[model samples]
Target: MYNKKSREQLLKEYQKETFLRKTVSFYKYCTIKNPQEYRDSLYQSFEQLNIFGRIYVANEGINAQISVPENTFELFLSTINQDPILQAIQLKFAVEDGLSFLKLKVIVKKEIVAYGIKSHEYDMNHTGKHLTPVEYNQSIQEKDSVIVDMRNYYESEVGRFQNAITPDAHFSKELLPMVANQLAGQEDKKIHLYCTGGIRCEKASAYLIQKGFKEVYQLGGGIIQYAQDQKKYGFKSQFIGKNFVFDDRMSERITEHVLAHCHQCGTKADSHKNCANQTCHLLFIQCENCAQNYQDCCSKSCQEFVCLPKEEQLKNREFENKRLTSLKLSTKFRPKLKGLQKNAV
Candidate 1:
């Protein structure tokens, strides 16, 4: 009923694997009858293929971010392409690959994206116009066009489309409403929305239309596909910097424009890393120098905590746990990973 293997054990197994894997994400917003049954079917197929990543299935369709073994990718694609519900699904492939996911997770969720909107708020059938990268680039340059980044603040901090409005929100549940409020009174404007993949924009464009916004459009396949298209066809990318992802490879560089600074030294850097200390695993940008200085930890305190002996560490952990527990909610998005006390080498 439960995965008994320790995290260390799982990681060792993952590292030992000789096969290659490719990460990709795909989603759709069609009616899915009996989600549990669909979930089980997906689990069986994915498990057989030794796939790893998070997946969500709901009555409104399925959302998946999986790493498929290179050997089985063709058969896997054929299986998905043959499915009536998932036929012709658009997949967003990762630009570069690393340790993507440790295990497979096929979850039964209420909504795939978790926009927290009522059924009346969005009509999936009436989503915004899907525009290709070329079309999007041209449309955005036109008058009365408003581009919005439909991802979290952390995601957009490192990279975004040129002149796009990034909402100051952490998670999806908070993002949609904040964007709506920010774009108030611009209902007639040509609202263009984008995400890592095109999934978020599907419901977002519909939600905007419901709010009386005229002329909503979305990136045909979002940043991942747009970047690939630009490279393949030899065109300048309107999107700049990295595309923040949820996998271990935090981001995939789209354009070489460094848009973010190192959270530690204030140097120009966009690479994100979780603190080496498992307890204070804060996600923040750290430059190569800081990575060496702080030993891959978020702060001096976290670095020191990691250096403590195993026996003494448990006693110290009791006090550390209380402090972290209290600060957990406040520092969820903007953690103590920001300013550090002069990093000691």
Candidate 2:
């Protein structure tokens, strides 16, 4: 049996916990006869296990990235394994710990990865060959190998494999097409792809292959699993900088190489952050100094906006919405990192 507290109570317990927990992610692509029933059953089971993370269920499949207590990790694994649909699924474990998420969120969505592609566009049975870290490292050295990063610009900014071609698209919907177009001429080349975990590459590789790519390969478990395997295999990590994650942890350093600049100071830093202003949470990177100086706001305008009275802020947001409609300014703001004191260095 499992127990669950309210979201507020869960936050309180997290604050008081003394033991370190592990953040892990896994996903599987399978046809579901009834998504609603599947979603409800999964929610009931995972919640009981006391798991904390975000899960997206859809007709296409399931995608999840979560953090669970080390004590219940085995139970969590066993619970999922017992499921007929999820049994024998290969989970990609994270190499570093950042306490990625604070609470559990199970959501039913349209598509697990949300590529906006029709269901008939990709064949899940024909995904790229999964290569371990050693194989990925060796394959890239071949004369015709082309490595590509299949993540958002912000995610690749923090950490990515050396010489990996990063698509300039900002959102997931645009990423697939841009990557396909970029590698159009190199169809016969040995195309190697990777993402934070293996999910993005899993679909991207299959899509590319469908688009005529001949020798497509994906890093077995993305960088997370690659970093873990590096310990035992003693292979020099080709990835440089921190691996950006979606949860509260933000990013994890994978190597000594820092190839990114601080978004504020343009210095040698690769840390990613969301603007601290609740009203406008734009995702970007800022160094420690900039983080301290700006209090995590994306700009001075946001800094000033956050200090206004609640009513005044609401009025201003309404006004800005009308004014910015023609200009099409994004209202998204970066959320403040939890557990860390607001604006406290």
Q: What CA root-mean-square deviation does each model show from the true structure?
A: 4.6, 4.8
lDDT of each: 0.83, 0.77
lDDT of 2 by residue, 93-141 (tens): 7777766666777777777887766667778899999998898999999
Which portions of model 2 show Cα errors greater than 4 Å?
Answer: 1-10, 309-311, 320-345
* Candidate 1, position 246, lDDT: 76
Off by over 4 Å in 1: 1-4, 328-345
Best by lDDT: 1
What lDDT tens digits, residue by residue, belong to model 1 across residues 1-345? 124577799899988989899998888888899999989988887888889888888998888888999999998888898788888888888877878788888888888877788888888778899999888888999999999999877788999998999998765777788999999999989999999888899999999988888899999888888888888887778899999877767788988999999988899999988778777777788999999999998778778988899877788888877766677667644453332211100
lDDT of 1: 0.83
Q: TM-score for model 2? A: 0.88
TM-score of model 1 vs. true structure: 0.91
- Per-candidate TM equals 0.91, 0.88
- At residue 138, candidate 2 shows an lDDT of 93
